[model samples]
Target: MDLKKILWDFFFLLFETGSHSAGSLLRQSPQPRHTLHAGPRLSASASSKELLMKLRRNTGYSFVNCKKALETCGGDLKQAEIWLHKQAQKEGWSKAAKLQGRKTKEGLIGLLQEGNTTVLVEVNCETDFVSRNLKFQQLVQQVALGTMMYCQSLKDQLSTYSKGFLNSSELSGLPAGPDRDGSLKDQLALAIGKLGENMTLKRAAWVKVPSGFYVGSYVHGAMQSPSLHNLVLGKYGALVICETSEQKTNLEDIGRRLGQHVVGMAPLSVGSLDDEPGGEAETKMLSQPYLLDPSITLGQYVQPQGVSVVDFVRFECGEGEEAAETE
Candidate 1:
């Protein structure tokens, strides 16, 4: 045999005898070569676990992202994080909008009441900033008013739009402006598409009330900015609905008390599923923290409470499902 060939064979034999080696050399030689993809070159010496940890620390992004960046960067941790950031700026954000789903614990609610006919709507967004946007607030306002008029299942409702959103497609019924047209649904999608992330409608509710005495709205945690139009529904709405009835005068006082109760209580279902004929005030006896969540109970209180809450609805925006609908 030639000297080079002999030496190569001998080295393989020597390598195979080593205790601390993986059989990687033999594996590489046996695999087909054309399967390689054309992408940025990555240094093969980097450890994936260490590189993943580095990318995660550098970017407050997802763990999947760090892994993907490493794969794209050929296991080079540094280049991978940079490339991942760039990728987020490009096509990855919409998919990588995992951050958008965090607690919206902040949002705007819309309530519409005309005469005795009353409606309450809650629209949730991912952050307080977007929740306070002019267009978004307008959309929620229009939606609440729309629900007042078009109380139908959302399955067939056309998407909605404001005066200046990006929707130039004929598919959306909007008129063509420099940046507008399409169905209302298209318009909402346009918002998500333009925002480079996820945008949602949380939940929507429609309520109607007759002769009770109180019908006012209050929004908590809403910014005082004129640009933001978030109005909180529910507690304020429940109070309004409760007051509009022609119940006893004591009932109206009880209604106000219930409003205060709702603001503080945040009961889950309007009442307990076990609430039966003898149901006293479900919130009467509880201490302070019971009403802070939908779960748990304040039970009942005595003092011969005179008012009874009629029907009420609670919809926690984005709490139970994914986006309201898929397009």
Candidate 2:
């Protein structure tokens, strides 16, 4: 009745039957390969290669550059990314400087508006073919929208518009989110590298209206269907600001009409010969014959409407560059 004796007798009976052997059972039994630490160490070279690939994918840098960055950072992914960015900044600025004096006669004007705030941006590339590129167009939109968003968030900084709305340095600092590697300048650099040509954020303007004022805009020669969202991807556009005594339901219509008129006439300013400062009589918006009704002057046409034109900005692509070249 003892347990050990009972098991021994049962095994002895099985061996006698000869259905299985102890040697065969021992051969089939599992055994430990080795100690955990005795296993192979991960390949450092493979890990470094993986980090290199990740850097290339995320930063859009050349494979050679990514590998060099990994090596420089001792295969640390985060440090490699930072090093790559520093290199990008250095290389981007160098590339920009080299292309600065090159004539950029072909590009698009991007515009965006939210509530009382609006922005206009001119982004230039070396060729018209590049201008039509979807990536380039998206860059223009991103820069415009990012700038508008930044300006709206910081009202006190809005005063900087007195000099100019944005400069290259300010644009380079804009937060462009993760897709653009955290800044507009980086996005631009990526574009330049991919397109193998020059790109410039030539100029930008921001307009914000006070209560009782309305801003309307129009675009001409858009590469795509002209809509409020993509209006800025056009050859020419105008932003017109109008002042009204009280908010009227018709103010938007009036502003839009004025915008269209400005786009057609390419007006220098909003006043007649008497009000304009030392300029040709025909250069003023109000002095020109109305676009809708050529028989009447613009001033005469708008006078009966009881609304006043406060300001206007008309942008024709390459106009400034043309003027500069002429001068």
Candidate 3:
């Protein structure tokens, strides 16, 4: 039987059987929807959105045309895009003008606390492209979360012996530059350079208390792709950390509750910036609480903008971080 006649017969069956028509067609052979195009496949399956971006960037066409082409070709990107261009001229539809530029800075600021340990870290990249890369973004999150679990109270309050230092592989040898041979900071900087974009530690915080129910944490957007995280992407993400009794709430429950609390009340410092946000950025950011609240004075929270605020590290991205330029 000719392929054309077979298709005609299938369509007739489709009309006769309605929903069952597709099922019958599927039972006979590979479903058309699941079939791949006759060309090289992407490294990973490109999302509909990603494909749309490729079309716009490569062809400088509109989103609508790209979408229509993709659908009309049964997900054949090449054919759909080609059809879009031709249709553009035939229909007098102006080429979808390239969307205006916005430095869609993408990355994430992760916050986590278990027991008395808590930390916040900013992992950023120049363009959304690198930021959205899964490996890059996940590295940032895991590091941030790990730092909170292990480093929070490890090194605070130096005695006559060792300086107030934290534990964890991270502080294994500090005063050792960003890398040791390189620190996480140094490693992050190198990654930014390698990717040809600026990346830096905007800020970080760690907290541990001797007693009391230590606050726990909750992630705002758990289902979001790590690659697509937007740290300075605007008020893009939220982290909720709250102080509660371990006795009253289970550890897992505490994290969820605190996260819920955070969704509502934007607590500053989780307690007090006076001893909260550690690291240089935190010290600088502490001023706002002083500036806004009359209860505290400059003698308390205020610190020289240039001074290091390492003590108050994970307090969310420091209010205003100076940008680094790459040569």
What overall lDDT goes with each candidate model? 0.46, 0.71, 0.44
In candidate 2, which residue pairs clash? none
Q: How does candidate 2 score on lDDT? A: 0.71
- Which order, best to worst by lDDT? 2, 1, 3
Error of 2 at 290 (Å): 1.4
Arrange candidates by TM-score, descending: 2, 1, 3
Candidate 3 residue-wise lDDT, 241-261, digit = tens: 233333443555534443443
Per-residue lDDT over 63-157 for candidate 2, one digit per residue giving the tens place of the 0 to 100 score: 99898988898878889888987777677667877766777778888777787787777788889999888767877877887787776776453
Best by lDDT: 2
**Model 1 Cα displacement at 47 (Å)?**
64
Of 2 and 3, the candidate ranking higher by TM-score: 2
- Runs in model 3 lying further than 4 Å from the true structure: 1-105, 112-115, 138-181, 223-246, 249-251, 264-319, 322-327
lDDT of 3: 0.44
True-structure Cα RMSD, model 3: 17.2
All models, RMSD in angstroms: 16.9, 12.1, 17.2
Better of 1 and 2 by TM-score: 2
Please give the range of 10 consecutive residues that has the lowest summed lDDT in model 1.
161-170
